[model samples]
Target: MKFTKILAAIVTTAALFSTSVASHADALTDRAKSGKPIRIGFAHEIPWAYPGDKNEPLGFANAIAVGVLKSMGYTNIEPVVTDWGGLIPGLQADRFDIITGGMYITGKRCKNVAFAEPMGKFGNAFIVKKGNPLGIHTYKDIKDKDATMVTVAGYVNVDEALKEGVPENKIMQVPSNTEMLAAVRAGRADAGAGTYFDARNLSESAPNEIEPTDPASLPEWTNNWVAIAFKKEDQDFLKAYNAAQAKYLGTPEMLEAVGKFQYTKAQLPGDAKADWICANR
Candidate 1:
């Protein structure tokens, strides 16, 4: 009788634990449906995710995230800002529920977090001194000229540069786009490497000091897509998010949300899916 009672207690506890685990697995989905606030993590990168004049979250990625969440009835959103390097760690630490910083969906990052479908595509470009004094039009130019390039720390541009044969010592990692521009303007580096839109935005802000390489000159392999990130365990939330995204993406609403940030229909990812990008990239 004693043995049977012990076995029964153990089974009951095991079943309770399994039920709790299942409930937790779908907690984010349930929370969203209940109108609970979802935290969005973003890096302070222009045209991706940044603070607007009113200090509200604004950027192409943020707009997409907000639009999708709103469509899913998740109206309450809390923005958590961090440096680029901190985005993944912050999400893992539960500091935010989603990463909406226009992060690239790389094969390496795929192992860390689940990504929603890509929102858009972009290519690399260089921010060079006015007139591109050193003729630094491409990653190959940077390598051939032995030019020092600066990019944001933790950005995929850093890896792209290295992959293109730019020496590790020739590439400098900074904390933000502003710093990258400063490095180039101050002559600390010959060029600033970033997304085509980022380089264009920075160059336009300081037209006399820098100019962006024609994005078309970039090799096709340098092209990449950006997506929002969610914790790997939040499969339920990611599923609902992707479903909403399918309905929202490529719609006029999506275009209007990102149009102000210089994104156009040309930038849409089309048939690009997160799983394919992860597997292939």
Candidate 2:
């Protein structure tokens, strides 16, 4: 009687285990079919996250984000705009499920949240005049510019430009890169410092209004990294995102997608084909 009772107990446990696995699988399928939109919060920064002409949250990262998430089986996705500085607080409050914007994963940032594996990298670039006619090649070049330097307000790039030794009084902070670029073109400033991709793309798309160049003299790199942040302790979502990133990064198709979005030059680790894939993908 004891042996028979034990065998029946074991059978009951096996049935319960099967039922749990089946339920979990059903949940995954149900979530995929829900048609409920995954609302993503975004902060504006050109070439990555920013508003469209109509003020819709739009840009490369915004675009890439929709594509990637949809490919992962989400159909309803929304881009909600928010102030850059307030993004984290909103995430912490559960205002959005994810941040589909351009942000780096750093040690300081990790204190508040978790991060996905690196998506790509970025390098700071200098926007100089035609022919680099100033002969300025380093961070020290700003002191030698004989003119002001421009950057956007509240951006680390401004701090970086300032650290290069330009007097605080000589630095101009504006609301956007457009304004900063205008200052450079109008000769209000000798040059501007910002993302490498933005400088290069502006030169390619606009032609002659602003020229893209690198500071050849700075002893330190401005900053270069790639990764995205998430709300605290959200390991379930983090696992999925990291899995998606690693899987995507290994494919030729991923490179093609990056090209489609034009993130090639800014994505780091020196993969020309990776660039091509990023651009094309």
Provide the overall lDDT of each model, using Cα atoms, as 2-decimal numbers: 0.90, 0.64
Q: After superposition on all CA atoms, how large is the RMSD of candidate 1?
A: 4.2
For candidate 1, lDDT tens digit of each residue in 129-154?
Answer: 99988998888899999999999998
Residue 228 alpha-carbon offset, candidate 1, angstroms: 0.6
How much RMSD separates candidate 2 from the native structure?
6.4
For candidate 1, what is the lDDT?
0.90
Task: Give candidate 2 regions above 4 Å deviation.
Answer: 1-36, 43-46, 50-60, 83-86, 89-95, 131-133, 144-147, 204-206, 215-220, 265-281
- C-alpha TM-scores of all predictions: 0.90, 0.69
Model 1, residue pairs in steric clash: none
In terms of TM-score, which candidate is strongest?
1
Cα lDDT tens digits, model 2, 1-281, are 99999999999999999998766633223443576667678776666777777766566566555556666767676667876666677778877767766765444455675656656666667677777778655556778765677776645565665666778887787766677777777788777776776677656655766678763344445554545566666666566756666556635665665575567744643432222332221
Give candidate 1 regions above 4 Å deviation. 1-24
